[model samples]
Target: MHPLISAADLRAWLARRPETVLLDCSFDLADPSAGERAYAEAHLPGARYAHLDRDLSAPKTGRNGRHPLRDRPAYAAWMGRMGVAPGVPVIAYDRQGGMFAVRAWWVLRWMGHADVALLDGGLPAWQAEGNAVTADVPAERPAPAYPDLPPAMPRIDAAQLQPRLGEVQMLDARAPERYRGEVEPLDPVAGHIPGALNRFFKDNLQPDGRFKPAEQLKREFEALIDTERPVVHMCGSGVTACHNLLAMEVAGLGRSRLYPGSWSEWCSDPSRPVAKGAAA
Candidate 1:
């Protein structure tokens, strides 16, 4: 099954199988509580809310980025509470161009759940289709224990990534301006990690907000680096970078590692080198 599902397909699935676990992973870095507030206002029918700071990320320690990956067992337990169990078909969506949704998708995938997917184009696409949105929250199911499930995805830490910079293709998923050191809105430092190529996550989507065709994504990524080459994805706080990773998966470009700490963590240490402007 593809990593993305269209709104029409999701609607059809919900009609027949109401047991499908739909998650509203909408979040805003500017105002963290806005996502839950928006969810309380209106969200997809039967969709449970997942907050980035509360549910998806672990506590900040001055070392990790703004949104660090949640502990494995705790996250699995949270997923269980959200009605996502082993073999359950989980679909995550968000309003902000699927940025937070892809993070949910990646988390589930990393937790050894192969039946997870992202709602293509996210909440906007569903709303655009004139689908009904409800304020009612779904009832929680009995939480299941997530045993030692080996991760299916690859991830690299800053320590492991720094030395491998020249060995692997590091893709920075931030905007062109952010990658070029033109703006520093969120993170303390502007510029990106040295040797990292800029590939804005938004490029994966079409004007209509849905992801482009697999062939198109394949062509675009191929122009940057070989499909078979080892690739590591990063962004401001390791959020939007998941969009790039999902795009690569949809493009059948094979799996890639994620630098979860991202730019924020990289810049936290003064010893790490920061590159300005575009990739050479």
Candidate 2:
């Protein structure tokens, strides 16, 4: 199945099956409380809120990156609480393009859910399509049947990535400025991981913020990596990197591995090398 869903398809799906689950994952890293407030004020009917820091991530110790991936069993319980079941379709959306939504999608895939997908173009697209927004929160339904199988997705850490830096294709999903070490807004360190090529996550989106066509993405990404080096993605704290991963899947490229410890964790320790001034 495609990793993305259109607003019209979502409406049709919900009409046919009211058991379809919708997740609102709008979040602002600058203000942690903003997403919750936004969901409270207004959101899609029957959509449950997934907080970036709270529901989506595990507790951060300073060592773990900003939004660490929740461990499997705990994550399974969380999904059970969210009403995910064996055959139910899960749709995730965010106000900021597909940034946070893709994270939910990727994590759901990792948790072995096959029917999960992102709301392409996100909440804005839904509103533009004339879908009604409501403040009504759906009553909680306990789905004890949510699967807890081993990860279907791939992942790597700084320890495993450091040794193979030169051998693998490490795509840094940060912005150009951040990749070039020009800014240091979030992390203490400015530069990206050494031997990493810059592939800004936003490049996957069209001018209107929707994802570019699959053919275009395939062509661009094919040109970016000339060799058969294994692909690994990373961003500020492994959040936006999921956007790139989702794009690759959309482009018919199979799911690639992710460095969950991304730049934030790599820079936390002074031992890891940081590179500056464009793709290396």
Best by lDDT: 1
Question: On a 0 to 100 scale, what is the lDDT of residue 146 in model 2?
Answer: 61
> Model 2: per-residue lDDT, tens digit, 72-125?
887788889999977788999999889888888888888888889888888888
Give candidate 2 misplaced runs (Cα > 4 Å).
none
TM-score result, candidate 1: 0.97
> Which lDDT value does model 2 have at 179?
90
- Model 1, position 187, has a per-residue lDDT of 82
Clashing pairs in 1: none
- Global lDDT of each model? 0.90, 0.87
lDDT of 1 by residue, 1-280 (tens): 4799999999997787777789899888888899999999999988999999999999998789888998898897888788877767888999877988999989988898888889998888999888999999877775576656889888999999888778888999999999999999988889999999999999999998899999999999999987788999999989899999999999999999999999989999989999999899
